[model samples]
Target: MGNAGRNAVVLVVTKVADATADLVIEQLNARRIPIVRLDPGDFPTSVAVNAYLGNHGLSGSLRTPSRIADLRGIRSVYWRRPSPYSVADDMRPQDAHWCADQARYGLGGLLGALPDAHYVNHPWRNRDAEHKPAQLAVAARCGLDVPPTLVTNDAERARWFARECGPVVYKPVRNTDYHGDDSRALTVWVEEVAPSEIDTEVGRTAHLFQQRVDKVADIRLTAVGDQLFAVRIDGAPGLDWRRDYDALSYTLIETPPEVAKAVRAYLDAFGLVFGAFDFGLDRHGRWWMYECNPNGQWAWFPDPITERITAALADRLQSPGNAHAR
Candidate 1:
């Protein structure tokens, strides 16, 4: 383990108890690669940063109780999910706000600028790819079949669009979990809708409506670097399979050649090396693109798929160039 390059560390920025990250870190440990696990939420108290511009280049180090990472020596970063920054509650409101701002722009900016570091999916790219409209447009351009979609805030427009598209479905433009006034978490599910069902309230905010595909099964294609895992999800029947996770089953499958090509092109368009794509396999055997999650979760998947993904990510992190596998 000592022979592993100390100058090249894989910086994993995710919160504690992230099972997926924990698995990947363990794999890296087995490979004897240096890793620095960080949770940005612990910035002031547990995480320390000392970054600056020097003669050689951007120079600094991040120090935690367990490990220290030289900013310049960071070979890659697994920018996994992390909690938001925080400040002490005892501080005055204004001072707390000011300190949080400094931490965000100061520490966040420097970390974001790590020299020659490879990001699983760069933060900026992840933000850009998260937009559904952008994703659909790019998928269509890549020769992928996307359902007729409309995003609008006008009730009349939505009604007319639904009428033209036939059996259309409404989905949240963003997957945001809400809480009801009763202090209970609320989840929105995709549901088929008719033109008459769209009310005037649709004009209040933007909504996404797409023609529902007559899908026989759902496919989740998780792309890690150059490796693509195609899993056919069955058992649950409805507008949204996600609503009934316990009822779902998974099977490892291969993506059609054309779909595989388009997946690569779609990722290339967004400058992303990782993306979780959803496709509906129509009864006619055609796959229709639903959406892509740039930072989507895939660890819940069972067995060999999880192990394969962990190995792929660890291999990518260990590679010096931080370039895409393919």
Candidate 2:
């Protein structure tokens, strides 16, 4: 291994400003691995990413000119966040945006393009990975069940379709932002639609609608390469399975061979090494695919799930002098 890849080993790029991310940093650091936590603002204007790591982890000198020096010896990276390029008050909106965008795009591109270091989930690959239509198409190709969905802007057209489907679902097309402190971001809402309910706002942004399946239970699938883990969750009236974690039940379910294969294929198709996926288990015990987050959160899951994920990541990074592979 080269000096960058050897003495100063694994680097984890995370939103270091958040408490949740801080807690995660403690855990990863406790694992006895050298970790570097970087906030997006830490980068210089018109900078290259030179993340210098010494004995003290991230506090080491970061020299950014030429930028290539900072990207050295990175065996692997975990794209954990709070996004670094958050809009702030000190700088003018336009000025801040120009710098933040440059740093965000440039840094991600530099590290992602590293000839040897492996990124846990490449940022470029994560792009277009969350489009519901794309996810649906990939799932279908894997032979998984998906509810009929429509992406429409015409209120009349959406109303007509919702009326036909009755209890359809409304989900954010991509990721949603939460402003409140200690926020919860899952906003999956189910409502029985009537034609009168449609509004002009639906046209402003494309409406993504799906038929609400009569879910017997829900499944959370976490995938790391070919390794797969699944947990069953029960959803009742009023609360979605995500928010009702307290009342819900969880069981380690052995994923069917085909289900595992499909999930693996879906990840590979998107060029992702880790994903958190959702599945609706119907009364017939059939699985309906929902979505897969290319850089999803999984720390809240049970120990076995956590163990499998952390081990898979560590294995890939330290794989017997293995060069960074897909």
Candidate 3:
């Protein structure tokens, strides 16, 4: 590494409880790299940003509790899951909402404007890539095998689509906070939907329905820059492997050249440098694209795979290069 990389700071934007971030930070620390970790949610409280625009460009400093980082000298930004911006609870509800919005745009904008730092997956890009509709369309365009999918809020249309694509599964367009009557968290797992189960309640919001893949296994392929680590997940109890993670076993697997090519193309299309892709392996050994989580978790995997992923991330973060290809 040259002086620029050797001396540059890696800004980690994430929550304090992230174990994945901690792993990468350990690697950087061992290499004696400079790192500044902060959560935007702490803005106006524990975190602060001071930026200036001049002839050169935007320059500033971010001060967190443990460290201060020079924006101009930042080499890379690991945009992990950061907490939402918040304000003092004593403020009126309206005032608090407005304050939070300002904090989001103000401090959030500054982080996005860092002059030289490369973001693993820029927040804006992550937001855009999070849409399942766009992801399916792009996956098909990139030569990946995407299941027949439909996104609609019309009850009749949803019923018709289910009839046509019988044995379909209902999936949430996006996973958001949902609670039951008891105020307990709830999850809408992917489940086989019979056409008769469709009703007017579906009209309340949009839903995603896809022909369920007859798969023998699932794959969680985590890509960091050009490096892809694929693992075959076996023994999932149902349609969604996530429902029973404890029952799953993993085996390191090689990605088919065609699938690998399409994955890179898909990432390029989204301008994403990192993505955790989910795929279903059919009985015939074909991979069906499910979705890609731009900022997905990886530390939950077994140690060997997790260590490899951590090293790949550290390699990308330590080097200076534009992750945003578009």
Quote the positional error of residue 123 for candidate 2 in Å: 0.9
Which one is best on TM-score?
3
Model 2 TM: 0.81
Per-candidate Cα lDDT values, in order, are 0.87, 0.67, 0.90
Rate residue 41 of model 2 by lDDT. Answer: 51
How would you encode candidate 2's per-residue C-alpha lDDT over 1-326 as one tens digit per residue?
35344454565566545543454455556666565555555566433345444563432233333223334555566666635665446899789888778766766556555545676777777776877789999989977788888888888888887888857777767657645566756454544455677788888988787888878888888776667778887644442565566776667788888888888778778888778889888889888888888777666766666666666666654442553355
Q: For model 1, how does the per-residue alpha-carbon lDDT over 17-79 read when each residue is reduced to its tens digit?
A: 799899999999998988899988898889999877967778878998799887778888888
Give the residue spans of candidate 1 off by over 4 A: 1-7, 320-326
Question: Across residues 46-135, which tens digit of lDDT does each residue of candidate 3 receive?
Answer: 988888888967877789999988778888899998999989989999999999999999899888888766888899999999999999
Cα misplacement distance, residue 76 of candidate 1 (Å): 0.9
Model 1 local distance difference test score: 0.87
Return the clash pairs for model 1, or none: none
Total clashes in model 3, counting residue pairs 3 or more apart in sequence or in different chains: 0
TM-score of predicted structure 3: 0.96
Question: Total clashing residue pairs per candidate?
Answer: 0, 4, 0
TM-score of 1: 0.94
Candidate 3 off by > 4 Å: 1-5, 322-326
